[model samples]
Target: MNRFALCYFLLCVSSAATAQDKEVQAIRTRYQETAKKVQLLEQDPQNAALYVHRISLNDKGTPWPAVGNYKKTIKFYFELGDEQVHTLVRIDITSESAAHQYATEYLFDAKGQLVFCYDRMPDGQSPENNIEVRYYFSGDKPIRRTEGKTISDKPSPEQQPQAKRLQSDAAELQSLFKAIDK
Candidate 1:
């Protein structure tokens, strides 16, 4: 390749990388802002328009007692407003036993899109060691994920399926909210 052509190609690639970096930064900023809003709402729950529902689940992820077992409990949090059923914002799932404890928090945007998920569970190597993972999404697409102190801008193969499941669970919970509102 000629020297001029090589230089032009490098410049183009550099510009593209810079633009992508800006986009990722924008996404991160937006996620942080939304997270702050969620925090404020949580702090003053009594003053916010909030709806909460709790359900018990067995080891198989089904409703408790149906399988004659009790495992975890999931709490759904919805922001009540004109949109009503379309305002699902957060979900907290917790499980505790003699052997281990696990918890996960799913956060959604105003449009009922899963935007962030925080999971805490035993690392499996030891009962005292727990791992925490934070997954961030732009709409239905995972953009960034973090495990403990390590962060990755690229989403992993499993994150896609996990994102879909979280979204599906949010939708199901929203449907339940709609039914209850009726």
Candidate 2:
């Protein structure tokens, strides 16, 4: 109520906002760096390690010719080092269908934490009908999210669950890749 008290409260609030803004900027920088690493590795395919897995949804044990059910394909990309350590950098999951087609890409940090995820689906035959969503994470938490052309500094309630699902999927895929590698 008093002038001094009001001024102090405003100053504290302003400081908090400034700190949050700085933190968000740092996260965005990290995201950009990670994205660059992925892009570079992807460009140089000869040096990158990639594993592809295909899933069939047919009731019978049939191959690709059987077209009634949906088919899913997953691609895992790893960064290879001289130390013989293969670090998983990206995972792409694509579902094939005549009517509905969607793809999700997940990117992991050096610590094997989910750092970013992108999901895209086409609403129609044209490129303009594409729906895209991107999520940027800090550790296991999503720090920012974007849908289409809109961006949000704070993750929505739905993003928490989606982040968890992506993390789980990444872990499972990593384990499968390790087993197959051995």
Backbone clash pairs for candidate 2 read none
RMSD over all Cα atoms, model 2? 4.9
- The Cα local distance difference test for each model comes to 0.70, 0.70
Put down candidate 2 lDDT per residue, 66-125, tens digits, no spaces: 453466777666666668777776777887554467899877767777777888888777
Per model, state how many residue pairs clash: 0, 0
lDDT of 1 by residue, 23-78 (tens): 55765675566556557666886665566677775546444443333388877776
Which ranges of candidate 1 are over 4 A from the true structure? 1-46, 57-70, 83-86, 158-182
The numbered model that scores best in TM-score is 2
Could you tell me the TM-score of candidate 1? Answer: 0.65
